[model samples]
Target: MTSQFEYGSISSLQEIQRLGEIIQQCFGGSPNDWERYLNRIGAENFRVLRQGERAIAGLGIYHMGQWYGGKILSMAGIAAVGVPPEDRGKGIAYELLSRAIEELYQLGVPISVLYPATQALYRKVGYEQGGSFCRWELSVASIWLQERNLSIYPVSPINYTIFEDIYNQQAQVNNGNLVRHRAIWEQVLEPPKEEAIYAYLIGSENEPEGYIIFTQNREKQESAIEIRDWAILTASAAKRLWTFLGDHRSQIGKISWRGSPFDPFLLLLPEQTAKIIDRMNWMLRIIDVPSALSKRGYPMGLEAELHLEVRDDLLAANNGKFCLSVSEGRGEVTKGGKGTFQIDIRSLASLYTGFLTPQQLQLLDRLKATQEDLETARLLFSGSHPWMADFF
Candidate 1:
């Protein structure tokens, strides 16, 4: 942290382009694509660590929300993080990410998520591998289908609202799914590039229970259908959607999902055809500890409280003890009394997302807790394994 090193948004087009060039140099993407992304998200969402007029490192901040423990939590997503090839190993990237976390904490965001190219860099800033992007691949012929009366219709532009409603219902019940904001919806529906994207809805027209968003592609006469997003609420709707996908076997060879580990569609496909083609680890950081814990939904039937001695290096405000209590599906976090368990920020991040169990952390020597505390911690942290479908 030098006096000359400033962290903030780019002020001019020249700076933005220069920053884009540096980002391109590090990220290996075309400048035009970066420009398009900046245009879509807006210039102000990006921040730079600069030495006076020179932008040495940059990161894009997204004001987003994720579902955790069956409820939506405010999340600041970090994207397009980069430093010039010349500036590597100078601590520029660390300062930029640290400042981004600090700013998000000050803005009252509870948690932060990012797709890390490497785990070590993020781990130093209290981030841990939190969730998984489990993409299931299946041959088109293998989708199980039973003949049903449910109708599947292509979603018109007028029916986007129905698609959104169905998604909200599905996301609310799943952990670590994004609560797609209005802007996000608008961004998703933007005109396609190269290949056309399709959206199909099942059930009644006015109130769709299930919908699938995907794209069709072919290379060297081998075609495949890629499922970009989807949600189904009922058995019949799921049958309809899988039957709909099953209908594609004649034209497409394979299907890939942008889904989590707990996808129901996997159950509808033949076990032989269904394979996990890719699993990407996404990292999370608990920026504001109390708020992150209190705001996320917990199981309603459980009752427990723990005195947590947390260690946060980047955010001084979070470096202390706190009492966390959960009851009736809500949490109450207050200042310290007598600390029961001692944990550092990275381990806490893992605990906060239910990515790792307290007992497991204690066994790994990342958490120190008594038997009673471990049992209570397990009950407190039990829920759907945290996973994010969207990568920003």
Candidate 2:
């Protein structure tokens, strides 16, 4: 282990294959199929930590443009980080992460996010906790069955365009929402060995209003169905969809859904035994201020202008503030004279994801604001708990 190590980019096809092989051996499974994974890394987003001519570690960054409230800009996502078993505990992973993060910063990537394998490691590397996604399980009989005027039909690939349009519209209006790109849709809708997948579209007056994606698992000799993603544009549509799931109570021993932490199901099912098995889902980082704020809907009939000082340890540019003025569901941002409230970019991200409240941030010493300023920040950023069922 005395060999001198050099850190740099790895792009050649042969080199990437070598890195993939090392990752497979380290993780006990193959990484994404070679060609697709490489394409995802693109030409410029892969990094390597090498010992002489041998690649000991590899990391990939996926650039995504997302709207946080209203601002839209490229955000960096760290994925597929791996190091050879022999290289573990040798600081190889840390070396690769540091390099990758710095490169993203240099490239103007304001926010970097990852689903951590170990929370402590990323926290040590300057990442902070954001949101928790709750995976809930309930008996099919848990929901009250109600007759609906809507019709339900199996969802197909042909409906993806409409499904996406509806989902994006809803997600944009909701806080703690992540903009799902086309690539994400493709992956989620077509996971491997997914023959048991099922989908249903709820239609009102012959127009689609909601959709549900689920999969049935019979491998355990128990009838269970897992709802992967579900969205409804109206209360009626939501009721119709739930009724459909409930109608199958005899065939379904248990019904599970991956949903936001604040999903009303828990309240909706009082007598049934329901569990929040998986607590956290997607982590968020604020890549752009104006864009992030503008995309989400705000509480009605409240208007305020506050200067925000956001401290980003990794990306320095997110530290400045523009004034945030909100009236009704509309908001405006302008270059302000000075900020009243002080907080870090991570704190802002936490607030954006509904994982941490302004009050909680204050308690953690992550927020720097006076009483009035704190109230203003709370009014602007506060909402129900945010959760993302999908993991990027």
> Who wins the TM-score comparison?
1
- C-alpha-based local distance difference test score of model 2: 0.69
lDDT at residue 142 of model 2 (Cα atoms): 77
RMSD in Å for candidate 1, one decimal? 1.8
Q: Positional deviation of 389 in candidate 1, in angstroms?
A: 1.8
> Cα RMSD for candidate 2?
3.8
Candidate 2, superposed: residue stretches over 4 Å from native: 1-9, 31-45, 51-53, 65-67, 70-74, 156-159, 191-194, 204-206, 265-273, 286-302, 316-340
Tens digits of lDDT, candidate 1, 1-392? 65768989888898899888988887787977787778766798889998877888988877878987787888888888999888899888888888888888889998988899888899988899787888788887777586467878886664457677788888887777887655466555554566787898888877677888888887568898877778889888887888888888888988887777767656765565687888988999998989988998888888889888888888888888899998898899998857888898899888877889998999899988888988888888888777766767
Query: In model 1, which regions exceed 4 Å deviation?
Result: 158-162, 181-193, 270-272
For model 2, residues 1-392, the per-residue Cα lDDT tens digits are: 32466777885777788877876675556456655666745736678888878788887776665444444446677777888776688777777776676666666565666787777666655666766667787777677667578888876554456577677766654444556655566655764565556777888536678888877877477788877677878777777877888888888888887766667645444364677777755556665566556655566777877777767665555567777778875677776537768877767878765567788889998888888877877777766665556665
- TM-scores of the candidates in the order shown: 0.95, 0.82
Q: How accurate is candidate 1 locally (lDDT)?
A: 0.82
